[model samples]
Target: MALKKKKSKKMTSTGTDVNITSLMDVLTVLLFFLIKSATVSSLELTPPKGMKLPTAEMKEEPKEAIKIALSKDMLVVDEKTMVKLDAGRFPASYLMEDGRTIKPLKEFLVQEYQKKKDFYKDVADENVDLLPPPTLLIQADHKLPFGTLKHLLHTAAISGFADYQFVVETPGE
Candidate 1:
Protein backbone atom coordinates (compact mmCIF):
# COMPACT_ATOMS: atom_id res chain seq x y z
CA MET A 1 0.00 0.00 0.00
CA ALA A 2 1.27 3.47 -0.91
CA LEU A 3 1.60 5.55 2.18
CA LYS A 4 0.65 9.19 2.08
CA LYS A 5 3.63 11.43 1.73
CA LYS A 6 4.51 13.24 4.91
CA LYS A 7 3.50 16.90 4.80
CA SER A 8 6.58 19.12 4.20
CA LYS A 9 6.98 22.39 6.11
CA LYS A 10 8.53 25.46 4.36
CA MET A 11 10.24 28.31 6.20
CA THR A 12 10.29 31.84 4.75
CA SER A 13 12.00 35.09 5.88
CA THR A 14 10.49 38.57 5.16
CA GLY A 15 13.80 40.55 5.25
CA THR A 16 16.82 41.57 7.37
CA ASP A 17 17.10 44.84 9.29
CA VAL A 18 20.54 46.28 10.10
CA ASN A 19 21.32 47.86 13.47
CA ILE A 20 23.21 51.25 13.09
CA THR A 21 22.95 52.68 16.59
CA SER A 22 26.56 51.83 17.44
CA LEU A 23 27.78 53.29 14.13
CA MET A 24 25.91 56.53 14.82
CA ASP A 25 27.47 56.73 18.29
CA VAL A 26 30.94 56.30 16.87
CA LEU A 27 30.33 59.00 14.24
CA THR A 28 29.12 61.44 16.90
CA VAL A 29 32.25 60.87 18.97
CA LEU A 30 34.46 61.41 15.94
CA LEU A 31 32.69 64.66 15.08
CA PHE A 32 33.16 66.00 18.58
CA PHE A 33 36.84 65.05 18.57
CA LEU A 34 37.44 66.84 15.27
CA ILE A 35 35.70 70.01 16.51
CA LYS A 36 37.72 70.07 19.72
CA SER A 37 40.98 69.54 17.88
CA ALA A 38 40.27 72.36 15.43
CA THR A 39 39.47 74.84 18.20
CA VAL A 40 42.51 73.95 20.30
CA SER A 41 45.02 74.10 17.43
CA SER A 42 44.33 77.69 16.51
CA LEU A 43 44.91 80.93 18.39
CA GLU A 44 42.52 83.84 18.09
CA LEU A 45 43.56 87.48 18.21
CA THR A 46 41.86 90.17 16.19
CA PRO A 47 44.09 92.50 14.20
CA PRO A 48 43.57 96.23 14.21
CA LYS A 49 40.87 97.75 12.00
CA GLY A 50 41.71 98.10 8.31
CA MET A 51 44.80 95.97 8.85
CA LYS A 52 45.65 93.09 6.54
CA LEU A 53 48.42 90.84 7.84
CA PRO A 54 51.00 89.26 5.57
CA THR A 55 51.01 85.51 5.05
CA ALA A 56 54.08 83.48 5.88
CA GLU A 57 55.22 79.89 5.52
CA MET A 58 56.55 79.86 9.08
CA LYS A 59 54.51 77.94 11.65
CA GLU A 60 55.73 79.23 14.96
CA GLU A 61 53.15 80.15 17.58
CA PRO A 62 53.32 83.68 18.99
CA LYS A 63 53.94 84.18 22.70
CA GLU A 64 52.37 86.82 24.89
CA ALA A 65 54.00 90.22 24.39
CA ILE A 66 53.20 93.88 24.15
CA LYS A 67 51.20 94.15 20.95
CA ILE A 68 51.83 97.02 18.58
CA ALA A 69 49.43 97.24 15.66
CA LEU A 70 50.17 99.51 12.76
CA SER A 71 47.61 100.27 10.06
CA LYS A 72 47.48 102.78 7.27
CA ASP A 73 45.80 105.39 9.44
CA MET A 74 46.41 104.30 12.99
CA LEU A 75 49.14 103.07 15.29
CA VAL A 76 47.83 101.09 18.25
CA VAL A 77 49.83 99.84 21.24
CA ASP A 78 48.19 97.19 23.36
CA GLU A 79 44.88 98.16 21.76
CA LYS A 80 45.42 101.81 22.69
CA THR A 81 45.85 104.41 19.99
CA MET A 82 49.32 105.88 20.30
CA VAL A 83 49.22 107.75 17.02
CA LYS A 84 46.87 108.42 14.12
CA LEU A 85 48.12 108.73 10.58
CA ASP A 86 46.77 111.57 8.46
CA ALA A 87 46.85 110.88 4.72
CA GLY A 88 49.69 108.41 5.21
CA ARG A 89 51.64 110.92 7.20
CA PHE A 90 52.47 110.97 10.89
CA PRO A 91 51.35 114.02 12.81
CA ALA A 92 53.72 116.20 14.80
CA SER A 93 52.26 114.87 18.01
CA TYR A 94 53.32 111.37 17.02
CA LEU A 95 56.88 112.21 15.92
CA MET A 96 59.64 114.48 17.15
CA GLU A 97 60.91 117.56 15.35
CA ASP A 98 63.95 115.62 14.19
CA GLY A 99 61.60 113.08 12.56
CA ARG A 100 63.89 110.26 13.70
CA THR A 101 62.07 109.37 16.90
CA ILE A 102 58.43 108.62 17.59
CA LYS A 103 57.89 110.70 20.73
CA PRO A 104 54.51 109.40 21.82
CA LEU A 105 55.27 105.83 20.97
CA LYS A 106 58.49 105.90 22.94
CA GLU A 107 56.73 107.38 25.94
CA PHE A 108 54.11 104.66 25.85
CA LEU A 109 56.71 101.94 25.66
CA VAL A 110 58.64 103.40 28.56
CA GLN A 111 55.49 103.49 30.64
CA GLU A 112 54.73 99.91 29.79
CA TYR A 113 58.24 98.86 30.77
CA GLN A 114 57.89 100.52 34.15
CA LYS A 115 54.62 98.78 34.77
CA LYS A 116 56.12 95.41 33.84
CA LYS A 117 59.08 96.04 36.14
CA ASP A 118 56.71 96.70 38.99
CA PHE A 119 54.81 93.53 38.20
CA TYR A 120 58.00 91.50 38.25
CA LYS A 121 59.02 92.97 41.56
CA ASP A 122 55.65 92.14 43.04
CA VAL A 123 55.79 88.62 41.74
CA ALA A 124 59.27 88.03 43.16
CA ASP A 125 58.20 89.35 46.52
CA GLU A 126 61.48 91.21 46.77
CA ASN A 127 63.13 94.33 45.42
CA VAL A 128 64.34 93.10 42.09
CA ASP A 129 67.43 94.92 40.90
CA LEU A 130 67.34 93.69 37.34
CA LEU A 131 64.22 92.85 35.39
CA PRO A 132 63.84 90.80 32.25
CA PRO A 133 63.97 92.46 28.86
CA PRO A 134 60.70 93.54 27.34
CA THR A 135 59.12 91.59 24.51
CA LEU A 136 57.39 93.50 21.73
CA LEU A 137 55.01 92.02 19.17
CA ILE A 138 54.47 93.97 15.97
CA GLN A 139 51.35 93.41 13.86
CA ALA A 140 51.80 95.67 10.88
CA ASP A 141 49.69 95.90 7.77
CA HIS A 142 51.14 94.33 4.66
CA LYS A 143 50.89 97.63 2.85
CA LEU A 144 52.94 99.49 5.46
CA PRO A 145 56.17 101.00 4.21
CA PHE A 146 59.52 99.65 5.35
CA GLY A 147 60.74 103.11 6.39
CA THR A 148 57.84 103.50 8.80
CA LEU A 149 58.50 100.09 10.34
CA LYS A 150 62.19 100.79 10.66
CA HIS A 151 61.49 104.00 12.49
CA LEU A 152 59.08 102.27 14.78
CA LEU A 153 61.65 99.64 15.58
CA HIS A 154 64.22 102.29 16.35
CA THR A 155 61.80 103.92 18.73
CA ALA A 156 61.08 100.62 20.42
CA ALA A 157 64.75 99.90 20.91
CA ILE A 158 65.35 103.27 22.42
CA SER A 159 62.39 102.77 24.73
CA GLY A 160 63.95 99.57 26.19
CA PHE A 161 61.97 97.09 24.09
CA ALA A 162 64.78 95.52 22.09
CA ASP A 163 63.30 92.07 21.65
CA TYR A 164 60.66 92.02 18.97
CA GLN A 165 58.47 89.47 17.23
CA PHE A 166 56.65 90.20 14.02
CA VAL A 167 53.18 88.73 13.95
CA VAL A 168 52.09 87.42 10.57
CA GLU A 169 49.15 85.39 9.40
CA THR A 170 49.67 81.78 8.45
CA PRO A 171 49.14 80.90 4.82
CA GLY A 172 46.09 78.85 3.90
CA GLU A 173 46.63 75.15 3.42
Candidate 2:
Protein backbone atom coordinates (compact mmCIF):
# COMPACT_ATOMS: atom_id res chain seq x y z
CA MET A 1 0.00 0.00 0.00
CA ALA A 2 1.36 3.54 -0.92
CA LEU A 3 1.27 6.20 1.87
CA LYS A 4 0.05 9.79 1.08
CA LYS A 5 2.69 12.55 1.67
CA LYS A 6 1.71 15.72 3.63
CA LYS A 7 3.04 19.19 2.57
CA SER A 8 4.38 21.54 5.31
CA LYS A 9 3.58 25.25 5.13
CA LYS A 10 6.47 27.79 5.34
CA MET A 11 6.24 30.91 7.56
CA THR A 12 6.55 34.30 5.82
CA SER A 13 6.59 37.97 6.95
CA THR A 14 3.41 40.03 6.71
CA GLY A 15 3.01 43.38 4.87
CA THR A 16 2.25 45.27 8.14
CA ASP A 17 4.99 47.85 9.13
CA VAL A 18 6.38 48.31 12.64
CA ASN A 19 5.40 51.53 14.40
CA ILE A 20 8.50 53.29 15.89
CA THR A 21 6.73 56.26 17.53
CA SER A 22 6.60 54.55 20.93
CA LEU A 23 10.27 53.61 20.76
CA MET A 24 11.22 57.20 19.85
CA ASP A 25 9.20 58.58 22.74
CA VAL A 26 10.96 56.31 25.22
CA LEU A 27 14.39 57.30 23.87
CA THR A 28 13.61 61.02 24.17
CA VAL A 29 12.66 60.69 27.82
CA LEU A 30 15.91 58.85 28.62
CA LEU A 31 17.94 61.55 26.91
CA PHE A 32 16.23 64.23 28.94
CA PHE A 33 16.95 62.40 32.19
CA LEU A 34 20.61 61.94 31.32
CA ILE A 35 21.09 65.60 30.45
CA LYS A 36 19.45 66.80 33.64
CA SER A 37 21.39 64.44 35.89
CA ALA A 38 24.82 65.00 34.31
CA THR A 39 25.10 68.76 34.70
CA VAL A 40 26.23 70.73 37.77
CA SER A 41 23.74 73.46 38.59
CA SER A 42 25.39 74.96 41.68
CA LEU A 43 28.79 76.49 42.41
CA GLU A 44 30.82 76.68 45.59
CA LEU A 45 32.08 80.27 45.67
CA THR A 46 33.59 82.18 48.52
CA PRO A 47 33.93 85.93 48.51
CA PRO A 48 37.44 87.38 48.58
CA LYS A 49 38.72 88.26 52.02
CA GLY A 50 37.83 91.76 53.16
CA MET A 51 35.33 92.05 50.32
CA LYS A 52 31.66 92.78 50.82
CA LEU A 53 29.19 91.11 48.49
CA PRO A 54 25.77 92.41 47.51
CA THR A 55 22.80 90.36 48.71
CA ALA A 56 19.93 89.05 46.69
CA GLU A 57 16.80 86.90 46.90
CA MET A 58 18.25 84.42 44.49
CA LYS A 59 15.86 81.68 43.47
CA GLU A 60 18.51 79.24 42.25
CA GLU A 61 22.15 78.43 42.83
CA PRO A 62 24.86 79.65 40.47
CA LYS A 63 26.06 77.23 37.79
CA GLU A 64 29.67 76.26 37.30
CA ALA A 65 31.73 78.46 34.96
CA ILE A 66 34.95 80.47 34.67
CA LYS A 67 35.18 82.79 37.65
CA ILE A 68 36.66 86.30 37.97
CA ALA A 69 36.91 88.08 41.29
CA LEU A 70 37.99 91.65 41.95
CA SER A 71 39.06 93.19 45.23
CA LYS A 72 40.79 96.43 46.25
CA ASP A 73 44.37 95.12 46.18
CA MET A 74 44.15 92.39 43.58
CA LEU A 75 42.20 90.84 40.73
CA VAL A 76 41.58 87.10 40.87
CA VAL A 77 40.39 84.33 38.57
CA ASP A 78 39.61 80.83 39.80
CA GLU A 79 41.10 81.72 43.18
CA LYS A 80 44.43 82.72 41.59
CA THR A 81 45.46 86.34 41.70
CA MET A 82 45.78 87.41 38.05
CA VAL A 83 46.98 90.92 38.76
CA LYS A 84 47.87 93.20 41.60
CA LEU A 85 45.69 96.27 41.34
CA ASP A 86 47.11 99.66 42.22
CA ALA A 87 44.41 101.00 44.50
CA GLY A 88 41.68 99.13 42.58
CA ARG A 89 42.99 100.08 39.12
CA PHE A 90 44.94 98.18 36.50
CA PRO A 91 48.39 99.38 35.41
CA ALA A 92 48.54 101.45 32.26
CA SER A 93 51.08 99.04 30.75
CA TYR A 94 48.58 96.18 31.07
CA LEU A 95 46.49 97.73 28.30
CA MET A 96 46.83 96.15 24.84
CA GLU A 97 47.68 97.96 21.58
CA ASP A 98 44.01 98.76 20.92
CA GLY A 99 44.06 100.80 24.15
CA ARG A 100 40.88 99.13 25.33
CA THR A 101 41.56 95.49 26.09
CA ILE A 102 43.45 94.40 29.18
CA LYS A 103 46.34 92.19 28.09
CA PRO A 104 46.53 89.60 30.88
CA LEU A 105 42.79 89.28 31.33
CA LYS A 106 42.21 89.07 27.60
CA GLU A 107 44.86 86.42 27.15
CA PHE A 108 43.38 84.23 29.87
CA LEU A 109 39.84 84.76 28.72
CA VAL A 110 40.68 84.00 25.10
CA GLN A 111 42.42 80.77 25.97
CA GLU A 112 39.51 79.67 28.13
CA TYR A 113 37.03 80.65 25.46
CA GLN A 114 38.93 78.66 22.88
CA LYS A 115 38.93 75.61 25.11
CA LYS A 116 35.19 75.92 25.65
CA LYS A 117 34.55 76.37 21.94
CA ASP A 118 36.56 73.29 21.16
CA PHE A 119 34.71 71.27 23.78
CA TYR A 120 31.41 72.30 22.23
CA LYS A 121 32.67 71.83 18.70
CA ASP A 122 31.40 68.27 18.39
CA VAL A 123 28.20 69.25 20.22
CA ALA A 124 27.38 72.09 17.87
CA ASP A 125 24.06 71.87 16.02
CA GLU A 126 23.50 72.38 12.31
CA ASN A 127 23.20 76.12 12.76
CA VAL A 128 26.37 77.79 14.06
CA ASP A 129 24.28 80.72 15.27
CA LEU A 130 22.64 78.43 17.82
CA LEU A 131 25.94 77.62 19.53
CA PRO A 132 25.95 78.75 23.14
CA PRO A 133 28.22 81.68 23.95
CA PRO A 134 31.07 81.30 26.44
CA THR A 135 30.17 82.41 29.94
CA LEU A 136 32.01 84.13 32.81
CA LEU A 137 31.05 84.21 36.49
CA ILE A 138 32.10 87.46 38.14
CA GLN A 139 32.38 88.12 41.86
CA ALA A 140 33.23 91.72 42.56
CA ASP A 141 33.35 93.88 45.63
CA HIS A 142 30.36 96.13 45.95
CA LYS A 143 32.57 99.23 45.92
CA LEU A 144 34.32 98.39 42.63
CA PRO A 145 34.24 101.13 40.06
CA PHE A 146 31.77 100.72 37.21
CA GLY A 147 34.66 101.47 34.86
CA THR A 148 36.41 98.36 36.14
CA LEU A 149 33.53 96.06 35.20
CA LYS A 150 32.94 97.90 31.94
CA HIS A 151 36.52 97.35 30.86
CA LEU A 152 36.43 93.69 31.81
CA LEU A 153 33.20 93.16 29.89
CA HIS A 154 34.55 94.89 26.80
CA THR A 155 37.69 92.79 26.86
CA ALA A 156 35.72 89.60 27.37
CA ALA A 157 33.38 90.39 24.49
CA ILE A 158 36.37 90.60 22.19
CA SER A 159 37.39 87.11 23.37
CA GLY A 160 33.89 85.72 22.60
CA PHE A 161 32.82 85.60 26.22
CA ALA A 162 29.71 87.73 25.87
CA ASP A 163 27.40 85.87 28.27
CA TYR A 164 28.30 86.63 31.88
CA GLN A 165 26.70 86.15 35.31
CA PHE A 166 27.37 87.78 38.65
CA VAL A 167 27.90 85.97 41.99
CA VAL A 168 26.30 87.75 44.89
CA GLU A 169 25.81 86.74 48.51
CA THR A 170 22.35 85.35 49.15
CA PRO A 171 20.79 86.26 52.44
CA GLY A 172 19.53 83.67 54.89
CA GLU A 173 15.92 82.56 54.70
Top candidate (lDDT): 1
Q: How close is candidate 2 to the true structure, as a TM-score?
A: 0.69
- Alpha-carbon runs more than 4 Å astray in model 1: 1-43, 125-130
lDDT of each prediction vs. the true structure?
Answer: 0.82, 0.80
* Candidate 2 displacement at residue 136 in angstroms: 0.9
What is candidate 1's lDDT per residue for 39-150, written digit by digit as tens?
4534456897778998888977777888888877888888888888876667767787778688988888889888888898888865655776888889999988887787
TM-score of each: 0.73, 0.69
For model 1, the local distance difference test gives: 0.82
Candidate 2: regions farther than 4 A off: 1-42, 123-129
Give residue 33's error in model 2 in angstroms.
29
Best-matching candidate per TM-score:
1
Query: Total clashes, candidate 1?
Result: 0
- lDDT by residue (34-102, candidate 2, tens digit) is 887664645678788898977777755566788888876787888999888787777788878876688
